[model samples]
Each structure stands twice: as structure tokens, then as C-alpha cells.
Target chain A: MILEASDISFSYGSHQVLEDVNLQLKPGMTAIIGPNAAGKSTLLKCLSGMLRPKGKVRLEGITLTTLKQEQLTRQISFLPQEFNTTAVLTVYETVLLGRVHQLGWRVSDVDTRIVNQLMQEMKLTDIADRYLNELSGGQRQLVAIAQSLAREPSVLLLDEPTSNLDLRRQYEVCTLIRRLTDSRGISTALAVHDLNLASRYADWVYVIQNGKLRCGGEPQSVLTETLIAEVYGVEARVTIGQETRPVITVLGPVPVASSDFQSERDAGNDV
Target chain B: MQGTTANDLNQAYERLGRRRLAVVVTVVMLVLVSLFLDVITGPAALSLPEVLTALFQPGSVSEATQTIVCTFRLPTALMAVFVGASLGIAGAEMQTILNNPLASPYTLGVSAAASFGAALALVLGSGMLAWTTTVFVPVSAFVCAMFCSLSIFAIGRIRGASTETIIVGGVALHFIFSSGVAFLQYMASEDTLAAIVFWIFGTLQGANWQKLAIIAVVMAVTTGLLMSRVWQLTALRLGESHARSLGINTERLRLQTLILVSILTATAVCFTGAIGFIGLLAPHLARILVGEDQRYFIPLSALSGAFLVSVAALITKLLIPGTIFPIGIATAAIGAPCFAALALWKRRSYW
Candidate 1:
């Protein structure tokens, strides 16, 4: 199923966060990359139906607003940028809760099986009984990913999924997500900060700047030095690594007088 | 390759669940035993067999014995169970929905309102309805409690039912009612002042079959309603945004649960006066014993609350030979140290 968003606009009170943003998510990993407060999270929230934007967002030609919350959640599983819990839920229990919509007084065999299989696939079986609060940051991230997959959703939206992880854990988690997206034929869009990681793992990239979609295409065409200098206000060298993905190396910050920086700063003030 | 790991993980998870279930069952049994002790340990100090015989076979015992067991002990003991269970369930859900560990029935000022109503009847109902004071106090308390909670609900609805707004509204209500209660205390006469203080101290002396039945029905309804939504409530522990992403209407859930908590707290506090600590302490103990899985947390919270109050009732009997101490005093006296110990013992930061 393709998640198609057209003319989507969202605002927080008087401050506009997303303006007429249009995008499509097909089966495979798509990365929404941008600077801080660039409306990447807002766009994903709009696409996932977590936040109702102005225009129509359709999943397989059906308008998202027409579906009930339960139906929408079953189709699109979303993991926010900051997913932390104070509850002393174990790894298995946390994942099992992804099936909360279908659960009754007694947890069914199917729910348990899905949770168990997801934990195993995520290699989280070792910490199945560990409390979520007690786990390491990387381990907790894996558990969260496992939880998102436990829904078996066709479309997965993750905001800053690797923000809390170390460098190695980031690579491993992105690789696992890419593998899962391809193998399960799921449309996975993640809002990421690392441009090179997005270039490596994402089949498609959407760059958001100042509450608008700046560019969207294959990583090689989308992550050019000019696009980075325009959107990020930073000088970067984009080189094709041996793996045929654009590897961006940041050189220095652009001057404060740049037009993009002024617009980004103005947008920040409105928020 | 995944088969063995999945099976092993399944078994491990089940084992943990079974352990939690065992803890719940044990706490339940403890409540029953405490209830029995409370019933038998009154002024007469009847033997176990005597109490049991009087309870089961009324014809076999003397009329006075039957009256003591049936009229006095049974209703009082059962009322403690109902009140404790109601507060426990309400407190657990309150904490969950508000996402605050300190939230309880009293936090919303329902108990304070009830105390004010009881004080109003005690201080004002002197000559006009002297004979009706007995019924009037409880009725006034019930009405005030319901009014306070409904006011909070209405305010919460108007403000969009966000957690901060609801909590702030509750705090504002709490201050308003507490001030009313304080003013009532200031103007009360000497004899009526004692009565007002006693009512605020909280006693189960007014427990009877009628009040017990009403509380029992409310508890059953709220507990059943909360039980049906256990998974959704558990999902909330992951935080509001996460729960919403999982398709939960968190605002609606909070409002509905608030209404249910209001009814539960109002009914529990009206007849019994302002029993404290059990609401705050029971859920924390339940969380310690069994994590936040509402399947176990809700039932265990109720049982632990029942156990705490039942034990407090027994201590009230045992404290002095012939007279009963006010249960609220006994509960706070007993609950404070145990809560401190549990806080010290559990190293995990549940909040």
C-alpha cells in the first residue's frame, strides 16, 4: 500500500509547521531528513494520521480521515522521536501492547506468538523479561522497533528512530529497518538527522526546510552539495562512497547572512 | 532458527505472569484473613468458632451475639473492603490517566468536599432536624462530593481535558473545598467542633447494609468498566503521544476515567468520612508487587487496599479493649511507616 499525502498543511496555533507538503511512501525505506525544527516530524505525523493536516492523506486511494483510529493504526504504526515510558513494562509486555486493539481479557495465542516472533527477530529475546526502564539506550531502541513491527503494519513512520543510539547501534538499527522494509514489503519513513545514514539506508530521501518539501528523489540526486548548503546552511562535500551511496562530509557552517539561514531563523521565531 | 527462541521467550514471559498472578492471589487471601480477624476481634472478642457460628448459623447463637456479628461487625468489615477496593481502583486509574504517582481520590478534592458537607451538617443541623442528623450528614456528604467531582469534570471538559489543566483544576478545587472545611471548623460550636473533627478524622461507625450495598454496586460497575479497558490503560503508561499513536483517544479516556474515579471516590468517602493514604499507598504497593500491567495492577491494588484497611480495622479493635479508634487515624498511623519502608525497599524508579 502506498501512503499518499497531497496538499497537506498543519499549524500549531498561529505558527505554521507544515505548508502544502505533498509526498508518497511506497514499499521500501524512505528518509525524511532535515535540520532541527524543520517540520520533518510534523510531516510524518500528518502522513501517519496522528495529526490531521489540512488536505487529504490517502492509503491505497482511501482517504485517511475516513478510517477509524483502529483501522488507521492497524495500517500505519508510528513511533515518535521520544518514546519513553515510566511504567515498569518488560520487553515482551511492551511489544505485546502493540496488539492492544485486538486484545481481550485474555491475551490470545496469536498476540503472544507475534510478540515472541518479533522479539526473536529483533534479537531482543535475551532481554524479554527486562524492564524497559532498566535497558540500555540502544537496547531500548531495539525494543521500540520490535514493538512498532509487532503491529505488522504496512506503513511504518518513525521520528528520529536513531537519535538516542550510539554510532554502531545507529548503523545496526538502520540496517535492520532497511532489511525489514524490503523483506516485509513495508513502506517505512523515518525522520533522521544524519544525512549520510539516510543516504546509505534510505532508497528515497525527502528534504524538508522551513515547513516545506525542499527536494525529494533518489539519495544521489537529492543529497547534492548545493541542496545541503541550501537546506542545512552548512558547507558539505558529497562524494559517492564505494557502496554507490552519497557520503556527505560536513566542512563548515554557512555565513549567517545566507538567505536560507534567515528564513530558517524566521521560522524558528514563529514557533 | 527463530522457533526455539520464541518458545523459550514465551515460556519465560508466562512464568513472570504466573508469578504476578500468584502474588495477586496471595494478597487476596490476606485480605480475606484480615477481614475475618477484623470481624471477630471486637469488644466482646468472640472466639473464631463463635464468630463463624454466629455468622453462618444465626439460630445457633444468642440474639445479642447475632446482633453483634450480623448488625455491627459484618457491615463495618464489608464496608472497609468496599471502600478500600473502590479507592484502590480509582487511585490506580487516576495515577495512570494523570501520569502522576501522587494523584488519588483526595487529589481531586472529593473527600475534602465530603468533609465539608459532614461538617456543615454537624455544625448547622442543631435544632431544626435534630433527629434527622444521622441520615442528613451522610446524604449531605454524598451530594457535596458528587458536586465537587462534577464541577471538576465540567472544568476539565471546558479546558480540553489535558493533564496539566485537569491537575491544576483539581488542585484549585482542593484548595477551595479545604478552605470551606476550615471555615466550617472555625465557626463550629464546642460540641459540634468535636463532631466535625471526628467526622473529618473518618470512622466506619456509620456503616450499614444500605450504604454498603450502594458502595458495592458502584465498585462493581467501575471495576468492571476499568477491567474491560485494562490494555488501553496499560498502553497509556507508555506516555500520551505513544498511546495516541497506537490509536487510543487519550483525552476521552482521561475524561471517562475521571468521571468513573469521581463516582468511585464520592461513594467511598461519603459514608466513611475522609479516609486517607489507602488511595495513595495501595497503588504504589501494587506497582511494587506487580508491575504496571493493569490486569494484575488493578486487582492487586484493590486487594492490597482491602488488606490495608482490613488490618487497620483490626488494629482499631485491638488498640483499646472495649472501644474502637477512628479508622482514618489508624490507617494513617499504620500506612505511613509501611509506605516509607516500601519506598526505601524498592530501588526502581517507577515514576
Candidate 2:
């Protein structure tokens, strides 16, 4: 199924967070790259039906607003940027809870099978009994992702999913999500801060700048030195190596910040 | 070597579920045992055989013994069970929605509102209603408790029903009602002051068949409603944002559960005159024994609460032999130290 958001605009009171943002997600890995508070998270929220934008979001040719919450949630799963819990819930139980809409007095066999299979596939079986609070940040992130997949959603959306991870864990998580997207034939979209990570893993890339879609295409075409310097307000060099993925090396922030760059910097600080 | 198989994983999870079930069953048995002890060990000092005969076969026992067992003690014993169960469920859901370990019916001013209502009745009698003092006190308390609860709900609704709004509103209401009670006490005559003090001390002495039935019916119906949303409640422990992303409609859930908890608490405390700490203590103990899977957590909370108050009732009878101690005072005197000890002893964090 294709997840489409068209001419979507959203604001927090009078301050607009997103304006005329249009995007589409097919069955592959799509990364939304932007600086802080650039409406990446807000747009993802709009597509997942967590927020009501002015324009319409449709999945498989049907409008999102027409569907009930339970049905909408069953098709699209969302993982927010910050989700940490100290409550004493175990890993297996947390994963099973991904099927919260379908859960009954007795857990069904199909739900059990899905959770068990996902745990094994994610290599989370060893720590299935460990409490969520006891796990490291990276492990918890992996468990959160596993829980999201347990919903069997056709579209999966994540916001800053690797914000707290180490370099190695970030690469591993991105790789796993990419593999799952291809294997399961589900459209996966991630809002990320790292340009190189998006270049390495994402099949399609969309750059959001100041609540609007700046540019989108294959990473090699969309991620350029001029584009990076313009959108991110930093001097950077982009090179396509033998691996065919663009690599970005940052120089520094723009020497003389423009008025627009300064305002975007201020908005980024609000987050 | 092969990694763990699906069969082994399933077995491990099922084993954990079984263990939690066992804990719940154990608490249920302890509650029943406490109920029996409460009935048998009152001031009348009947023998075990005599108490059993009076309870099951009243014809064989003497009329006085039967009256003592069935008429005088039975209602109070049963009241403790139902009231404790009601408070337990209320506290468990309150903690979940408020996202605070210390939250309870008392934290939301339900008990204090009830107290002020009782003080109004005891100090000034019923001015508007023609009912006797016997009916006036409880009715006034229930109305006042509901009033406090609804006002908090209204304030929360206006402010988007955030946790902070509800808690702040409840705290403000608590202080207002507490001062109202104090003012009433200051203006009362000696006899009325004594009556107010006695009611605040919270005795189960006023328990009757009608009050017991009302609490039982309300508790059963509310519990059934809560049980239907066990998955949603458990999802709440994951944090509000996550639950909302999963389409739980968290604001609506919080409001709906708050209403149910208010009704449960008002009914339970209005009859018993503000029984203390059972609502606050039971859910924490249940969380320690069983984690936040509401399937186990809710039932275990109710059972543990029923067990604690039932035991408190028994201690009230046995503490001074002939003199019945005020149940609220006994509950605090016993429960506080026990809860403290449990907190210190448990290596795992119960919160």
C-alpha cells in the first residue's frame, strides 16, 4: 500500500510547523532529512494520523479521517522520538502489547506467534524476561522498534529513532529497519538528523526545510554540497564513493548566518 | 548449539503468567481468612465452634450468639471486603492515569471532601432535608465527595485534563474542604464536636446490610467496566504519548477512568467515614508482587486491598479485647510501618 499526504499544513496555534508539505511512501526505506524543528516530526505525525493537518492523508486510496482510530492504528504504527518507561513491564509483554487493539481477556495464538517470531528475528529472545527499565538505551530502542513491527502495520513511521544510540548501534538499527522494510514489503519512513545514514540506507530521500519540502529524489541527486549548505546552514562536502552512497563531511556553520538561517536556528532551539 | 526455541520461549512466558495467577489466588485466600477472623474475634469472644454454628446453622446456637455473629459483626466484616476492593481498584487506576506513585483517592480530595460533608451534618444537623441524622450524614458525605470529584473533572476538562491540572485542582479542593471541616469543628458544641471527632476516626460500627449491598453493587459494576479496558490501562503505563500514538484516545480514557474512580471512592468512604491508606498501599504492594500487566495487576490490587483492610478490622477487635478500636486509626498504625518495612526489604523498585 502507498501512504500519501497531500498539501498538508499544520500549526501550533498561530505558529506554523508545517506548510504545504506533500510526500509519498512506497514499499521501501524512505528517510526524511532535516535540521531540528524543521517539521519532520510534525509531518510524520500527520501522515500517521496522530495529528490533524489541514490537508488530507490517504492510504491505499482511502482518506485517513474517514477511518476509525482502531482501524487507522492497525494499518500504521508510529514510534515517537522520546519513549522511555520505568514501569515494570517485561520485553515480551511490551512486544505483545503492540497488538493492543486486538488484545482480549486471553491473548490469541496468532498474536503470540507474531510476537515470538519478531523477538527471535530481532534477536530479542535472550532478554525477553528483562524489564524495560533495566535495558540499555540501544536495547530499548530495538525493543521499541520490535514492538512497532508487532503491529504488522502496512506503514511504519519513526521520528529520530536513533537519537540516543551509539554510532555502531545506529548503523545496526538502520540496517535492520531497511532489511525489514524490503522483506516484509512495508513502507518505512524515518526522520533522521544524520545525512550519511540516510544516504547509506534510504532508497528515497526528502529534505524538509522550514516546514516545506525543499527537494526529494535519490540520495546522490538530492544530497549535494550546495543543498546541504543551503538547508542545514553549514559548509559540507558531498562525495559519491565506490559504494555509490553520498558521504558528507561537515566544515562548520555558515560564517555569516543569513536572516532566514538565524530564524531557523531559533526555531530549532525551541525543540 | 541451537538458540532458544519458540516452544521454550512460550513456556517461559506461560510460566510467568501462572506465577502471577498464583499470587492473586494466594491473596484471595488470605482475604477470605481475614474475613472469617474478623467475624469470630469480636468483643463477644465466641468460640470457633460457636461462631461457625451461629454463622452456618443459627438454629443450633443461642439467640444472643447468633445475633452477635450475624447481626452485629457480619455486616461490618463484609463491608471491609467490599470497601477495600473498591478503594483498591480506584487507587490502581488513579496511579495509572495520574502517572504518580503516590496518587490515590485521598490525594484527589475525595476523603477530605467526605469528611467536611460529615462535619456539616454532625455539627449543624440537616437543615434542608427532613431525614434523620442517621441518613443525613452519609448522604451529605456522598454528595460532597461527588461534588469535589466533578469540580476537579471540570477544571481538568477546561485545562485539557493534563495530569498537572487534575492534581493541582485536587490539592486546592483538599485544602479548602480541610479548612471547612476545621472551621465547623471550632463552631460546634461539645457534644457535636465529639460526634465529628468520632466520625473522622472512621469506624465500621455503622455498617449495615443496605450500605454493604450498595458498595458491593457499585464495586462489581465499576470493576467490570474497568476490566473491559485492561489492555488500554496497561498501555498507559508505556507513557501518554505512546498510548496516544497507538490510537488509545488518552485524554478521553483519563477522563472516563477518573469518573469511575470518583464514584468508587465516594461510595466506599461515604459509608465508612474515610478509611485511610488502604487505597494508597494496596496497589504498590500488588505492583511489587505482579508487574503492570493490568490483567494481573488490577485483580491483585483489589485482593491485596481487601486482605489489608480485612486484617485491619480483625486487629481492631483483638487489640483491646472488649473495646473496638477505630478502624482508620488501626489501619494507619499497622499499615504504615508494614508498608515501610516492605519498601525497605524489597530489592526491586516497586514504583
Candidate 3:
């Protein structure tokens, strides 16, 4: 399936967040790497049909807007930056919610099997009966990933899936994500802040700078030192490490350009 | 090691499942017992045989005893069950839609609007409806309360059905309608004020078979509709955006649940004034006992609510020797403390 977005624009009230954003993807891992407020999350929301944008999102050549909410969900599953549930449901019950679209009033055997398989695959078998409140941040995120995958989506969109995790958990989550996406042949889009992780896992990378798609392609080609410096306003070194992953080391914050800031402010008036 | 872990989990799940089932069944039994106790232990001195005879074989009992059981105890006892179950369902639905533990039909000004409607009818209703104030008051209360909630939900749609929006809208509507009732009280004649005050106190004193039948019909139809959407509702517990991502149209779900909640709450409160606490506490208590799965959670919530109101009525009867204290006040006294304890008690995430 081909997931494509074209000429998409979004604004929250008068503040325009994304403009004329375009992207295309096949079945592979894609990372939307950007600084804070660079419309990475907004673009994902647009593609997921959470927020309607100006143009069109085509999922496998069908206009996403034309599909009903139920029809669209079968093909696409989005995991937001933070999805919290304070209800006292067990981990098994929480993941079972992923099959909500399939279940009737009672939980079917097929549903139970799928939930059990996903929990086991995610290493959540031990905590299956534990309350969601009892889990740590990383564990909760794993549960949420299991939930998103429960629907068996062809396309998965995640917004900052590893932002809250420690170094090891981050690697583990990214590795799990890569393994799942690869095994399932699912096209996955992740909005990530960690550039090295993105370069490591994301087969394709889109570098967004200030709500615009600055550039995109292969990670090594797109995540250059100049692009990182310009987009994040940070001095950094980009190098190929032991493997093929682009390793980024930040030096210091770059001084702000008053002219650039003023011109951006003036551009905001056009919205 | 894996075998032991899986076995332990399976055992734990089974134990918890059995425990929840036991608690729910016990509560249902308690509600049934409370119904009988409520009928038999009234001010009228009816022994077990007399009360049973009045209940089963009216011809065997005296007319006065028959009248006492049929007219007073039966209707009031059943009203608690009907109203309790309805508000419990309403509270569970509201909490899911608003995503707030404290959310309920009463807390969201639904019952207050019903009271205001009843107050308006009492203060200003004329000859056209005077012959059947019973029907008129409830009909108008249902309409006005539905209108109030529909408007709240419409406003909520604009704001995305977040907790703050719903709660703030509820607080605003609550103040408006409650102040409306208070203002009507200030202007009402002695008879009118007394009637309105009595209605607002939320008693089962006025329950008749007819009112019970009407509430029962609405409760059955609405609850059936809600039961069909249990899976969707369970998904809603994961927050609105997540539910939406899972193919659940959260906005439509919120609107549907809100309207149903309004109807249930209005019908329940119109007959019995604005009874509080049951809607707020029942769902929380049910969640504490039986996790957040709506299939069991909703029914348990309904039963818990019925149990609370029925117990409240019995407490009201027992408080004094002869005169029956209003069940609504007794509920506040009884329920508020229980809610406080539940709130203060260190459980895993009350909200």
C-alpha cells in the first residue's frame, strides 16, 4: 500500500502549523525528524485524519477523507505522543481494547488469541493481569504499541514513541518497532527527536524545518550536519558509526538570527 | 519458569474474575433483600405474613394493609431500583464520555435542569395540565433536561468533549438552572413553594405504579442501546483521541451517550427529584470491584446504585419512628461519606 499526502496545510486558529507538506511511502520505516513545533506531529495527525488539512491524504490510492472513520482505521493506526488511561483495567484488558473494532459484546476466542500473542510478543505476558497504573512509562508505551498493532493496520503512525524512554528503553522500543514493522511489512511513520535513533531504524527520513518539509530521502543522505544545524539550531557532528547508523553529537546551541526571527514573525502575518 | 509465570497469571486472573462475580452477585442479592425490607418495615405495622399476603395475595390482607403495600411500599421500593439502575448507567456513560471519575448526570446539571423544569411547571402550569400534574411535570422535565444536555453536548462538540469543557459547561448549566429554581422559589406562593421544595428533595414518596412503568420503559430501551455499545465505550476509557484512532467516532459516541444519559437522568430525577451521589459513586465503586470492562462494569454499577438508593430508603425509614425522612437527604448523608472514603482511600488511580 502506498501512503501519500500532498499540498496539505493546517492551522490552529490563526497560527499556521503546516504548509503544503507532501510525502509518499511504501511498506518501510519512515521517521519524521524535526525540532520542536516543526509540524511533524501535525503532519502525522493530518495523515491519520485526526485533523483535516487543506489538501488530500490518499491511502493506497483512495482518498482518506472519503473513507468512513471505521474504514480508515482498518488501514491506519496512529499512536500519539502520550495516550494515558487512568482506568483500573488490567494490561490484558487494556490491550484487548485494540481489538475493540472486531469484538462484539463478549470477547471472542479469536480476539483473546490475538491479544495473548501481541502481549507475549511485546514481553508483556508477565504483566498481562497487572493494572495499567502499575506499569512504568516504558511499559505503558509498550502496552500502547501492542494496542495500536491489535487492529492489524497496513500503515502505522507514531508521534514521538520514544521521547520519554531512557537510553536502553529507547533502543528496545525502536528495535521492537523495527522488528514489528519489518515482519508485518507495515509502512510506519515516526515523529522522533533523537536523530541517531531515527537514522538507525528509519529506512527513510523526512527532515522538517519550521512546519515545512525541508528535505527527505535515505537517512544518511537527508540527515547531514548542515541540515541538523539549520533545522535544530544546534552545532552537531554527523558520522557513520560501527554499523550504517548516522551518529549525531551536539556541540552547542547556535545563536538565533534576529533577521530570520523577524522575517518569520512577518511571515506569520500572512496566515 | 515460563510455565510457572503463565500459570500464576492464569490463576490470578481466575481469582480476580471469581471475586468480581461474587461481589456482583452478593450486591444483587442485597438489593433484593433491601426491596423486601423496605416494603415490610414501613410505619404501618404489618407482620411478615401480612406483608407477604399483601404482596402476593391482596384478597387475604385487609384493605388498609393492601393499600399500604401496593400504594406506598411497592412503588417506592421499585422506584429506587429503577432510578438507581438508570442513574448508575447514566453515571458510567457520563464518566466515560467526559473522561472524569467525578462526572455524573447530577454533577453535569442534568438533574438540576429537570428540577428547574419541574419547578417551572409547578409555579406557572395552568388548567390545561392541572388535571395531570404528575404526567405534565415529568414530561416537561424530560424535555427541558434533554434540551439542557443536548445544548451542553453541542457546546462540547465545539470544544472536543474534553473534561474541562464538559465540567465547565456542566457547572455553568448547573448554576443557571439551580438559580432559576431558587428564583422561582423566591416568587412562588406558599403551596407552590412547598411543592417545588418537595420535588427538589428527591423523595420516593410520590412513586406510583404509573410513574414506575414510565421510568421502566425508558430505562429498558436506553440501557439496551447502551449495552450494545459496550465495546466502544470500553475503548473510550483510553482517552478520546486514542479511541478515535481505533476507529471509534468519539464525537458521535459522546453525543449518543450524553443524550442517553440525559434521558435516563431526566426520567429518573423528574419523578424522584434530583437524587445525588449514586451516579458519581456507583461507577467508581464498580470500577474498583470489577475493572473497566464495560460489559460487567456497567451492570455492576447499576446494581450498586440500586443497592445504594434502596439502602438509603431503608435508612430513612429507620431514622425516625413514625414519619419517613426523605430518601434524597438520607442518600446525601450516607453517600457523601462513602464517596469521601472512596476518594481518600489510597487505591490504584481512583480517576
Candidate 4:
């Protein structure tokens, strides 16, 4: 599958959040790593059809803009950064909701099988019968991921899925997402805050700044000290870690003059 | 080393399925028995044998017994069960769509709006629009209830149709309608005031075969429409964004469910007046029993509602036997305590 976006631009009323950004993705795990408020989530939302951008997004030969919402959603699943489920539904019941598109008045055996398999795959079987309110933060996060997986979508879009989780759980969740992307051949784009994790788990990396793509390449080539210093404004060292993956260790914040940050934002991109 | 086998899932499904079935069957049988008892225990009470004979062989019974059983008691009894069931289903739908456990026909001011309409009609006389050749009181009440719902929706649409917006809008409407009713009571004549007050204190005395038939048909069709989208409704229980990702049109579902709830609440309360707490309590009780699967939750809500109303109907008679109480009084008297207890003491979290 090929998902390509060209001249993609978006704005919230008077503010331009994204400007003439373009990206081409194939079925693999891709990570968009950037500083806070860098428009990574906005780009992902546009690609996932949650927001309409003023450019062309094509899946294979078909245009994404022309498709109906239901059709677009069936092929793409976007999990937002924050959500609180109001219903105290069981884990299994909530996960089964992902297959609602395929099920009718009654849940089919096939639907149940897929949901249970995801619970098993996501290692949520032990807590499947437990209410969502009873689960810890990490467990709930995994359960939500399992729900997204249950859709059997060909493309997965996650917005900072590991933001609230602990370091160990963050690693675990990212690894699991990476494995699912590889095994199922599902195209995935994750907006990430952790540079090391993105370098370690992501097959392709795109560094975004001010709603524009700064660079895109393999993790080793993309995670340079200069890009980190410029994009995140932090002093950092990039070195090879276990499994030959790039590891970034931040030393301190690079305190640029106040005028630099303000000027860059004020000089809005001309789309 | 092995993942959970399909056999395990199959076993769990079977066990839960049986439990659901047992709960349904038990409630249904209880309702059936209560329905039978409710029909015979009126002011002119009859023995079990006489009641059964009257039921099984209506033609052979004396004219008086027949009138007591078939004409008066039977329709009211059936009205209690049907009205309860309809309100229950409507309550569950409101909770799912509004994403608030406290949202129901009464809490959202739909009932109060109807109450205001009924009060307004009585103050003006039922012949306010006699040329229409329809019962103006119920028609007026239904229209006002629907208008209140639409007003809430309009407010929501203008400023993001979120749960909080709609709920606050409902509360505001409740106060507005309540004030309207109070004003009508203040201005009414002595006879008009009494009639309006009696209507406000909802009853089953107005029950008859024709009214029951019309409500039953409306309920059957509306409930069918609701049941057809049971899965989507269940998914909606998750959250707006989650339902959207899972391929549900959240906006459309919200609009449709809103219209359907207005229809249910308006029709349920039009003839009956403003009965409170049943709608709020029934859905919460159903969720506790069924764990939020709308297929079971919705039907179970209906059955539980029927059980509650039937019980209330009996309480209305037995609380002070010589003088019967209006059904709303008994419903509030019974339902409020349970609702308060659940709010205070119930350990389980509903949403």
C-alpha cells in the first residue's frame, strides 16, 4: 500500500499549523518525532482523514478526500492522545466495539475470535473481564491499542500513544506496535516525543518543525546532533546503542536568545 | 507458551450467554405474574379463582366482574407495564447518546416540558383547538416536549454538541418549564387548577384500549429502530472519538438518537403526565445487570422498567387502599430511594 500526501497545508482559523508539507509512506513503521507543539499530531490527523488538509492525499490510486467518512475510517484507525471512556465496559466488550463495523445485531464467531486474539496478542487476556476503570494507566493504554488493532485497519495512526505511560511500559508498547506493523504489514505513523525510542523502533523517521518536514531518512542518518539541536533546541549526543540503533542522550537545553524562537514562528511559511 | 485457545473463549461466551438468558427469563416471568396480579387487585378485588375465570372465560363472568376486570383494571395494568418498558428503553438510549448516566426523560426536562404543555392546555381548556378534532392536551404536551429537545440540540449544535453542553442545556430547560407550570397553576381557576394539578400528578385512570394500542404501536416501531442499531449504540458508549475511529458516524448517531428519545419521552409522558425517576433508575439497573451490551441491556431495561412500574402500580393501590394514589407519586416514592441509595451506596461505577 502507498499513502502519499503532497502540498498538504492546514490552519486553525488565523494560525497556520502545517504548510506545504509532503510525505510518502509505504507499509512499515514510520515515526514522526518533533518538539512539543511542532504540529506532528496535526499532520497525522490530516493523513488519517480526521482533518481535511488543503492538498492531495492518495491511498494507492484513489484520492482520500473524495472517499466517504465511513470508507476512510474503515481503512484507517486514528487513536487520539487523550480519551476517557464514560462507560465502565469490560475490556473484551470494549475491544469488541472495534469490530462493530463487521458485526450486525449479534456478534459473529469470527468477530469474537479476532477480538480475543488481539487481547491475547496485546497480552490483555487476563484482564479482559475486568472493567476499564479498574485497569492501570498502562493497561488501559494497551487495551485501547488492542481496540484499534481489532478494526483490522490497513493503516494505523497513533498520536503520542506512550505519552502518559512509564518508561518501561512505553518501551513495551512501542515494541509491540512495531511488531504488529511488521507482522501484519500494516502501515503505521506514530507521533513520538522520545527520540531514542523512535530511533530504536521506527523503520523510517521524519523530523518535523513548525508544521514542516525538516528531514526524513533512516534513523541513523536522521537523528544527527545538528537536527536535534536545531529542531528541539537541546544539546544532545547521538551514539549507537544495543542492536545498532541510534541512542540520543540530552545534555542540556540550548538557551538560544528569546528573539530566535519568536522570529521563527512569526516568519510563517508561504504555502 | 500457547495463546488463549478459541475453546476458552467459546466456553466464556456460553457461560455468560446462559447467565444473560437466565436473568431475562426470570425478570420476564416476574413481570408476567405481576401483570396478572395487577389486573385483579383493584378497588373491586376478586379472588384468584374468580380472576382466573374472568380472564380465561370473559363471556361467562357476570357483567360487573367483567367490567371490573376487562374494562378498568386490565387496561391500566397493561398501561403500567407498557409505559414502564417504553420509558426504560428511552432512558437507556439517552444515557448512551448523551454519555451521561443521569440523563433521562425527566432529568433532561423533556417530561417537565410536557408537564408545562399539559398545564397550559388545562388552563385554556382542552377545547383550545377543538376544530383540530384531536385531544389537544396530549398533542400540546408532545409538541412542547419535542420542542424542548430540539432547543437543546440547537444549543449544542451552535457550541459543539458535547455531553456537558447538552446536559446543562437540559437542566436549564427543566427550570424554564417548571417555572412555566408554576405560573400556569397560579393563574388557573379553581376547577382548572385542580384539573391541571391532577394531570401533573400522572395516573393510569386515563388508560383505555385505544390509547394503549396507539402507544404500543409507536413504541414497537421506535424500539425496533433503536434495536436495529444496537451495536452502534453500544460502540457509542465508548466515547465519541473511539466510535468515530471504529467507523461510526457520531454526528448522525447523536442526531437520530436525540430525535428518537424525544419521540419516546414525549409519547410516554403525554397521557401519563410527568413521572420521574423511573427513566433514570431503569437504565442504571439494566447496566448493572447486563454490563453494557445494548442488545441485552436495552431489552433488560424494558423488562426491568415493566417490573418497576407494575410494582409501583400495586403500591399506588396498597399504600392507602381505600383511596388510590396517582401512579407518579408511587413511582417517585419507590424509585427515589433506590436512586439515592445507588447514587450514595452502590459501589460499582456505571460510566
DockQ of each: 0.73, 0.62, 0.51, 0.53
User: Chain B TM-score of all predictions, in order?
Assistant: 0.94, 0.94, 0.94, 0.95
Native contacts conserved, per model: 0.88, 0.70, 0.75, 0.57
- Name the DockQ score for candidate 4: 0.53
| Candidate closest to the true structure, highest DockQ | 1
lDDT by residue for model 1 (B204-254), tens: 887889889999998999888988889999999999889999889987887
- In every candidate, how many clashes are there? 0, 0, 0, 0
**lDDT at A68 for candidate 3?**
85
Better of 3 and 4 by TM-score: 4
Candidate 2 residues lying further than 4 Å off, grouped into runs, are: A258-271, B1-4, B126-130, B339-350
Error of 2 at B81 (Å): 1.4
Q: Say which prediction, candidate 2 or candidate 3, comes out ahead on lDDT.
A: 2
Candidate 2 lDDT, B1-351, residue by residue in tens: 223567677888999999999999899999989998888888876899999999889899899998888888999999988888888888899888888776787777888899999989877673543453467888889989999988877887784567777788888998899899999999988877887888877878978888898999999888988899999999998888888887899888888988898899999988888777888888988988899999999999899889888999988888787998788898788768876877688645545
- Which sections of candidate 1 miss by over 4 Å? A257-271, B128-134, B158-162
Q: After superposing candidate 4, which stretches have Cα over 4 Å from the reference?
A: A257-271, B1-4, B126-134
Docking quality tier of model 1: medium
The order by descending DockQ is 1, 2, 4, 3
List TM-scores for all candidates, in order.
Answer: 0.95, 0.94, 0.93, 0.94
Error of 1 at B153 (Å): 3.6
DockQ of candidate 1 relative to the true structure = 0.73
